[model samples]
Target: MKINPLLVGLFLISPVFILLISYPGFSVVDSSEVFQVFKFTFHQALVSSLLATVFGALAGLSLSSIFDSKKYSFVESLYYAPSFVPVLFVVFSCLNIGNLWQISFKGFWGIVVIHVLINVGLVGALYSKILIHRLSLMNRLSLVQGLGVWRYLRKIVFAHTKKDLLFLFAVVFIFCFTSFSIPLIIGGVNSTTIELLIYEKLVVLGEVEQALSLALLQLLFLVFFLGLINFTQAKEKAITTSWNPFFKNKIFLLVPIFSFIVLFVGLWLSASFSLGWFTELALLPTLIKSLGLALFCGYSIFLFFQFIFSILPHSTFEFFMSVYSSPSTVLIGLALVVVSSVWWQGRWLVLLFGYVLLYVPVLFKMFVQNFLSSLKPALKVSRAMSANYWLRFKMITFPLSYSLCLFLGFLTAIWVLGDYALASLLLEADSTIALVAKNLLRSYRLDQASFVITIIIFCEFIIYLLYKGLAYVGGQKY
Candidate 1:
C-alpha cells in the first residue's frame, strides 16, 4: 500500500495546524490593547535586530584582524561562550550586573540589551569568518590601490558583506520577534510580545479564540520572515564563497574585541558562579532530570526524522521541514498545552510529541544536506537493488549517519535541557531542571540559581565533548 507523503507531512504538523484552525469566532474585546502589544513587539524586534546586526559587524570585523594574527584561540571564549552557556544564565548575569550599576533592566530597553548581548557574538563570528576568508584579496586590493579605510569599507567590505549583514538581520529579527523567554522573564506583563500573548491566552486566561487569533497573526509574521530568510540565504549563496587566514594589521579592531570579551566574562562571573553553593545536595536531582529529558528529546526527534525522511519524497520532505521554523516555541508549547488539556493524563507524551514537531525541522535543516550528500552513493545502490525503504535506510543510510545522528541527538538534548519556555507550560517545576532554575531566579534565589546554572553549563561542556568525540570516532570509521 502506498502512502501520501503530503498527508504524512500534514499529519506530522497537525499539532501546529490544529492551533491555527481551532480559532473560535473572532471577538475584538480589546483591539486597542492587542494592537498596542503588537506595536511593542514589532518595535522591540526591529530595534533588537538592527542593533544586533550593527554590533555583530563591529565585533566580527575586529575579530577578523585577531584571527589573521593567529591569536584565534585567545578569544575563543568570547566567540563560542554565548552558545555553550544556557540563555537564562546570560539573562541573569546581565540582570545582576545591571543591579550592581543601579540600572533597572525591567522593561523594553532591558529586552533589547539582552538580545544584543546574546546575538552580537554570533554576528561578529560570522563577520570574522567572512573577513578572514576573503582577507587576502581584499587586503591586496586596498593596499595596491591605496584605498583609504572608508573607501575600502564602502567599496569592498559593504559591497561583499551586505548579503551576510541582511542574513544576520533577518535571523535576529525572527528570533526577537518570536522571543518568549527573555520577554517573559524581564519584560513583565505590560511589555509582552505577541508570542507571550499566545501563552497568556492559553495558559493564563484560557481564551482559546483570542489565542488562536493571535497565533495566526504570529504565523503571518513568521511566514514573511521565513520568506525573507529564504531570499537572503539564496542571495548569500549567490555571493558568498565561505571563510579564514588573511594578514591585515588593524590594531583598532582589538579594542572592540577585548571589550566584548570583558562584557561577557563580567556578566558570567557576576551571575552564574558563587562559592559554597555546590554542597546543596539537591543539585543532583535537577541534573538527572535535565539529562533524562535531553536524552529523550534528542533520540526521539532523530528517530522521527529518520522515519519521515524514509517515507517522504525529497520535495515533500523539504516542505514539511520548512514548516518546522514556522511557529515560535511559545506558540507551539501553548498548542500542545491545549491539546493535552483534552486527554489530561498523557500531557507528558503530548509534550514530547510537541518536541519532535517543533524541533525536527530544526535538526532536519541542520543535518539533512550533509547527511543526504554523504549517503548518496549508498542510497543509489539501495534504490538500484530495489530494496524497501526501511531496508535501504537500515542497510545503507543509518550506518553512514548513526554517529552524526547521535551527535545531533545529543545537541538537541542539550537544547531541550536548556529550554525553559516550552517546558514551563508542560512540565512542573520539579520535573524539568530548567524550570527549577528559572523559578529559583524569580524567587530571588540568585546564588542557588547560579549554582544550578553552573552545573547546567558543566553538563553542556561534557555533552559538547561527547558530541565531538562521536564525530571523531565516526570520522575514522566512516
Candidate 2:
C-alpha cells in the first residue's frame, strides 16, 4: 500500500500536536520576568553567534590553505570534534579548567565563551569546505592577479560567503538561545535563558500553563527565524589546487586545537581514582542502562531514517520535513510527561520517541539531506524503469547510504549517552550515567563527575567501533 508523505510528516510532528491539544487554560505569569529572560537570551545568543562566526571564518580561511593536502585531512575532524560530543562533556571540561585556573565560568561571558568554543570548530570546518568547494576557482584567479590577501578576502571571499556566514550565525544563535543544559549548568541566576525559565516553570514551580506559554513563544521565535533563512545546501564540486602560502596562517587553527586540548586536559586534571564510588553508588546498573539506551536510540534513529528513505522523492514530504522544526526540548518532555501519566509503563517508550523526533531532523540536515539529494538522479531513473519502491531502496539507496546511516546512528547514540536534559525530565531517578554525572557536578564532586564523563566517552568509542565494524561488514555484503 502506498503511504502518503503527509501522514509520515504528521507522525513526525504528532508530539507538538499533543502539546497544543493538551494546553490548559492560560495562567498568569510574570510578564516582566519573562521579558528579562527574553532580553538576556537574545543578547547572549547574538553575541555568541557573532563571535563564533568570526572565529570560525578565521579558522576556515586558515584551513582552506591545506584543503588540497591529503596529509592534513584529519585536521578537519579537529574543527568538528568539539561540537560532536555531548554538551555535558564540554561543560564538565570547561568547569574543570576553570577550577584549575581559578577562574569563574559562570554567567553571560562564561556562557559565550563555551558557546564560541563549541561552535567555532563547526563553523571553521564548514567555512573551509565552502571555500574549497565554492570559491576555489575564484581564490586561484585572485592569487594569480597579484591581489593582496587582505583585499581579496574583503572583496571576493566575504562577498561570496556572507550569506553562508549569516546562515551559520542563525544556526548558532538558535542553539544558544534555546540551549537548556549549558545554560542550566553554567548560567548564573542573572543569566537564565528562556529554555531554563521554561524548565523552572514546569519542574520547580509546577506552572504547566506558564511553561507551555513560554515554550510556544520560543517556538514562534524559531519559526520566524527559520522562515527568514533559506537553508540551501551547496552542491559538492571537486577542486584541485596547490598550497597557497597566503592562506597558511596557523594561528587560526589554534582556536579549535586549543578548545580540543582544554577538554582533554581538564578532564585529565579533574579525574581521580574513583573506583569505590562506582560500585557504592550502584553505577553499574546505570552504566548498563545508559549503554543499552544509547544502542537502542542509535538503532531507532537509523531505522527512522530508513523509513523516511523508503518513501523517497516525494517533494511535498521532503519539503515538510525540511522546514519542520522539532518542538523545544522542554516542550517535548512536557508533552511526553502528559502522555506518560495516562498510560502504564509508557514513560520509556515516549522518552525514546521524543529523542528520535528531536535528533532525526538534526542528522537529516547534517548528512542525510545531502546524501538523499545526490541520489535523485538514480532514484528517478529507477522509477522510470518500473522498479518497485522496495527494489529501488534495496538496490540503489540502501547500499549507498547505510554506512552514513550507521555513522549518524553512532552520533545519535553518543548524544543520547551524554544526554541529561530529557532524562532529568522523564525519569524519576538518575537512570543514566549522564544524569549521574550531572548530579555529581551539581554536588561539587568534580573528580567523580570527570570519571563518569570518562566512562561515557569510553562508551562512545566502543559504540563507534561497533558501528565501524557493522559498516565494514555491510560493505562487504553489499
The prediction achieving the highest lDDT against the true structure is 2
Residues 207-270, model 2: lDDT tens digits: 8888888887887788677656645434444354444344667788888878888888878887
Give all candidate RMSDs, comma-separated.
4.6, 2.6
Q: Predicted candidate 2: what Cα RMSD to the true structure?
A: 2.6
**For candidate 1, lDDT tens digit of each residue in 1-478?**
3456676567656766776565547644378877898899999999988997887787776666663243664564455456445678767777777777787777999899878777777667656766755454665667677787788778878888786677668767777888888898899867978888888877899787777777767777676666656555422222233323233544534434543554556546655465556545366676786787777787786676666556544654564454346566766777777788788898877877777766665556544533554466567777889988778777777666677677667768777878888888887775777787888888988877877776777788787777778777777766
State how far residue 206 of model 1 sits from its true place (Å): 1.9
Residue 439 of model 2 has an lDDT of 90
- N/CA/C clash count, model 2: 0
Name the candidate that leads on TM-score: 2
Q: Which stretches of candidate 1 lie over 4 Å from their true place?
A: 1-12, 20-29, 64-77, 129-149, 235-281, 301-324, 338-346, 360-410
**TM-score of every candidate relative to the true structure:** 0.80, 0.92
